[model samples]
Target chain A: MEALVALSIAVLTASGVWLLLRPRTFQVIIGLSLLSYAVNLFIFSMGRLRSNAAPLLEKGVQADPAALADPLPQALVLTAIVISFATTALFLVVLLAARGLSGTDHVDGGEGRQ
Target chain B: MSFLADHLIITPILLPLLAGAAMLLVNDRHYRLRAALGLVSTLALLVIAIMLVQLADVPAGDASLGRAYLLGNWPIPVAIVLVVDRLSALMLTLSAVLALCMQIYALARWHRAGLHFHSLVQFLLMGLNGAFLTGDLFNLFVFFEVLLAASYSLVLHGAGQQRVEAGLKYIAINLAASLLFLIGVSMIYGVTGTLNMADLAMRLPDIAAADRPLLEVGAAILAVAFLVKAAIWPLGLWLPNTYGAASAPVAAMFVIMSKVGIYAVLRVWMLVFGPHAGASAYFGGDWLLYAGLATVTVAAIAVLATQDSKQLAGHSLLVSSGTLLAAIGTGQAGVVGAALFYLISSSLGIGAFYLLIELTERNKTAGADILAVTWEAFGEADDVLPGEEEVGVAIPATMALLGISFILCALLIAGLPPVSGFIAKFALLTAAFNPEGLGATGEPISTTGWLLLAALLLSGLTALIALARAGMKIFWMPASTRVPRVRLIEMAPIGTLLILCMVLTVQAGPVLRYTQAAAEELFAPESYVESVFGAPRAGELPQEAEL
Candidate 1:
């Protein structure tokens, strides 16, 4: 299970970086979203990828530390996801504005002949 | 007053947040009320920051190293903590001073140029304060995003073609950097099982040798994110364009933004990788030195090539950042103290220069730059008609104020005599050359030291030449320039900032003492760790608090 999750993250990151280098703004925005997803999964898996384990403690009840999954990474992942989502939205609006003003999708504000 | 003092550590962050939200509900047309609100909030922040600095300036082994505020009354290492030591307090004071100046300057015209201008400024201040005071790494990330969001809006505040274009590149690059920050942070968390900075520091030394390489990789990636923000060369290519394109007040506020990266590097590196970190001691020091020297070299050359005063200011920021980075790379306590002093002087100068650029360019024709360059390139002797020169006319009052301000700004930026800039550079150089308290060691200066010294000296010289050339064109040339209608509201902020720099020069003795104490506290992390962990949780005795 850990191997599968790690492989998926690697693939997502590779593709995202490739698209991020592309000249188009839309591609860059999509690339950012993809990169964020990979990061989210990576942060989630940092808790050692436990299966069928309780994530929280019962009130006034003692629980074995080994039987429970690490919960901090999950919280961290949640925060990362929310921030990335907002930034991606912000990036889209900026992309549209840049296109409207400069009349080009290229990142440098110049028309690419290619 | 004592009750307020107990919570003083959190006021710098919360006051701005509440003020910004309140300003949003008021109608934009009610500019007077909004401006008043913004002023009150910023003034309060300045006062609060000063109080915090005094509170944090206590010597080591004092009962309370600083005031630590834990949110939600949770236990240490679990709840979010805001720790204000000497370093954080010093930064808070600088930030609050800059924000107040920018707020006052923006009131003249820039605030009306966009929606929520005052709110955005307030939010940016909140982020800066939080980032300075937070003890958790993840909380720092959250604050970083807050500031970046506000900055993006501010960069495009005027909605000009140049702004939109520059804003596009700026947003994209920072988005990528944010991703890198997350990956690096999470990787470290995975290795250490902790996100609190002091907790991480405690855990670093105990990590097995087998996992050390992963830890180093995470740290290096994290350093990359910071270096980008710090405007280190190659990674900082976005700064000149973005800062050059931002509105004057926004650009002025951004002078502290790059320093945020420097502060983070200093805080994190000293805490987690100091001498106590076993194998990770001084990790990435060499890379920091080389990168800083390269940034300085490039910025100096680039400063010469720019005709626009705003771009020149941006490049000067890169120079300041580079010098600080190199100073940090030296791993010497005295040098870091000098760097802290230099940081204060240069940030104030650059902030004042950004505000001054707009006023100085108000009356000049758009084509004046092109005309000047053309005249220099091909000798335009025909345009110099005889006897039409008004060389001996007394300068207008407006022109006089602008000229004096411009000259003072030049002196401060270029590290010339009779200003804090010269004092800062002299202190930095002397400290670099003589590493005091090293047990009478006669070791020669390393090759890196020579390179750093050369970089610092040459950058200063380059700034002097560039500013002289630019100033001559703006203030001394025989161009058909009209006297700008300067407002007292506008001119007062610039005067205030410059006066503060002069105050720094006059009070250098006491300020240097404070910074030296702060630097000493920084090199010794045990005190910081103890302070964070020693704070009492609500409803519990101090001695009962535990992880």
Candidate 2:
């Protein structure tokens, strides 16, 4: 499970970075989304892989910390996910605006005579 | 008053946040109420910041635990904590003053150029204040995003072809940096199992030997993320374009944004890698020093080459960031104190310069700067004698005011004599060259010290020349340019900012003394950790919940 997660993160990051370097704004936006997904998973996996374990404890019950899944990383990952989502939406709007104003989809707004 | 003082630490963050949310509800057509809302909130913030500074200054003895407020009345280690130490209070005060001045300046005309200007400025302030006051890394990331989001919208506020293009690059770069921030943060969490800065510091020295390299890698990546914001060398190439394309008030408000990165680096480096961190002490100190010098060199050269006044101010920001980064890298308490002084002086000067540029360049044709450069290159513009201009033609008040403000800004940014800039550089060089304090002098300065001295002196020289040439082109050529239509409302903010710089010059002794004390407290992290751990929870905890 650990190897699979790590391998997927690596692949996503690689492809995302490759796309990010492309000239088209659409590709860059897609790249950012991919990169953010990788980061979110990386944050989530930091808690160490646990299956069939509770993320919380009863109000008055005590349990060894190792028996329960680490909840802090879960919370951190959730925040990261929301923030990335908003930023991606904002980026898309800007990308579309740039395309309209500059008359190109290239990242540097393309080479065109004004 | 006593009750208010207890909660003063949180007001800087909360006041702007509430104002921003409320301002969003108001119609943008109601400019009067929106302006008044911004004004009242910023004025109140300035007052609260002053009170917080006073609170931070109370001598807490050896146990100099700063004022720590755990949110939701939770215990320190696990809960989000807001700390008001001398360093943070100083930053809060600086940002408040900048925000108030920028807000007033925007009131003249710039605020009408876009929607939700007031709310964006208020939210930007909230982000900056939160970044400074938060005591945990995760909260820092959140505040960082908050500021970046506001800045993105603010940069695109007066959306033109240039602004949109520049804004695209700026947002993309920062979004990448944000991802890096998360990666580094999560890596650190994996290693340390704690995100609270104080708790991490307490636990770093005891980590297993096998895990040390992982921690260092995490820290190095984190530093890179911050250095991008601080505009260190290669990572900072986007700054001049982005800042130059931003509107005047937004760019002025952004003068403190770079410092946020420097502040983060300083706080994290001192707490997590200071003397008590054992084997991990000063993990990346050498990298900081060299990279800082490189940034200074490149920025200074770029300052010489920059033709536009707005771009010149942007380069000046890079210069200040580099100097502060190098000073912090030195790891000397005295140097850091002087760096703090330099930070305040340069930020005010740059902020004023950004505002001044819009007014000064208000009437010039778009190609005037390039044409002037060409004329100078061809030696067509001769040096006009003082006697030539004295043919019974008195200088107009607008010209005189603009010229005087321009010269003051040049002097301040160039670190020339007769302003706080000179004093700041003097103090920085003095402390850096003599790191052993007064009594322990006579140890020869290191090679890095010599390099720093050269970088600073040379950078100042370049800045002086660039500013002088730009000033002459703008002011000396009366035939080619018209006197910009200046308004009292606009002029007063620039005057106030310059006057504050002068005040800093006059009160240098007391301010330096305060910064020195702050530096001393920063270097001693035991008190900070103790304060965090010692902060009382609001109520008794359940038996099972007790640690």
Candidate 3:
């Protein structure tokens, strides 16, 4: 399970970085999304890959931290995912605006392309 | 007053947040209402920040009393804590003062250029104050995103073609940096099992030898994320263009954003890795020093080459960041104190300069833009003649005031005499030279120290020449340009910032003492950890066994 998670993260990051270096604005946005996904997964896996464990405890029950999945990293990953989503939306709008203004999908606003 | 003082640490974060949310609900057309609300909240924040400083400055003997407030009453290490030590309080006050000034300046015109300008500024303040006061790493990342999100919108506030272009690159770069921030943070948490900074510091020493390399890798990655924000070299290429493209007030507020990165480096590096962390002491010290110097060199050269006032200010910001980073890398308490003073002086000076740029360029035609483009394409527009010379127009009174402000700013940026800049540099140099002041190890100044000094002097010289050249062209060489119609509202903020710089000069003794004390407190993280965790609960790790 650990190897699979690590391998997937590596693949996502490699592809995201490759796309991020492309000249096209759309590619960059997609790249950012991919990178964010990898980051979110990484953050989630920080809890040490717990399975069939509760993140919460019952009332009046003493908490056995070792038996429970760490809830903090899950919360952090959730927050990060929300933030990345909002930022991606904002980036898409910015991409469209750039296209409209500069008449190109290039990241440099077609400054050097011309 | 006592009640207010007890909750003071949270007010800086909460006030701006609530005000921003409330401002969002107000109709966009209701400019007056939004402005009034922003003004009241910022003014109140200024007062609260001042009170927090006093609160944090409680006598050393009574230091353990009334500082750290654990949120939700969860015991130390488990709950989110808000600490109001001298450093956090000082940073909060500086940011509050800048926000108030920038907001006031924006009210004159920039606020009307876009929807929700006031709200975004308020939200940016909320992010900044939260980042400064939060005691946990995850909370810091959350606040960082909040501020970056606000900045993304604010940078595009004016919505010009240039702004949109620059904004795209800025957003992409910062988003990437944020991803790194998350990965680094999670890695650290995975290795350490904690996200609270003080708790991490306490636990770092005991981490098994096998996990040490992984922790170091996580820390180094985290530093990369911060250095990108701090505008260290290679990673900071986006800064000059982005900052130059931003509207004046937004750019002014951004002067603090880079410092946030530097503050993180100082706070986290010094606390967790300083002197403690048995195997990990001085982890990234050399990298910070050299990269900082490289950043300084790049900024200095850029300063010499920049044609526009805004770009110059941006490069100057980089220089300031580099200097602070290098100083912190020295690990000398006195140098850090002096750099703290320099940080305040230079940030205020550069902020005022950014504000001054728009006013000075107000009178120029499209000639400035043409010159900028030509320089960009051809790398020096010597062939281009000075655009049509007009007959001499009578110089307005505002011109002289602006000229004086420009000179003061130039002097400050260049680290010339008779300002706080010179005092700061002098103090840093003296501390570097004094072997006794270089911590208890008493190590002699290394080659890096000499390189830093040379970089400082050379950057100052480059800054002087650049500012002089730019100032001469704008103020004196422009034969017949019309005087920019500066308003009192605009002039007042610039004057206030300059006066604040002047106050730093006049009260250098007390100010230096304060920063020195702050630096002392920062270096001695024991007090900080204990204060946050409480005296008795700090070293007791039985709870950790249960966990």
User: How does chain B of model 3 score on TM-score?
Assistant: 0.92
Residue B12 local lDDT, model 3: 87
- For B446-508, candidate 2 gives per-residue lDDT tens digits of 887798899889999999999999998788864346676777888889999999999999999
lDDT by residue (tens digit), candidate 3, A40-98: 99999988997899889766677877888888889998899999999999999999999
Q: Score the docking of each candidate (DockQ).
A: 0.68, 0.73, 0.75
The DockQ-derived docking category for candidate 1 is: medium
What are the per-residue Cα lDDT tens digits for candidate 3 across B5-37? 567778888898999899999998798899989
Q: In candidate 3, residue B115 scores what lDDT?
A: 86
Backbone clash total for model 2 is 0
Report clash pairs, candidate 1: none
Model 2 chain B: weakest 10-residue lDDT segment is B377-386
**Count of clashes in candidate 3:** 0
**How many residue pairs collide in each prediction?**
0, 0, 0
Give the per-residue lDDT of model 2 (tens digit) for A1-114: 999999999999999999988888999989999999999999989888899888998776767887899999999999999998998899899998999978999878776532
Q: What is the C-alpha lDDT of each candidate?
A: 0.86, 0.87, 0.86
> What docking grade applies to model 3?
medium
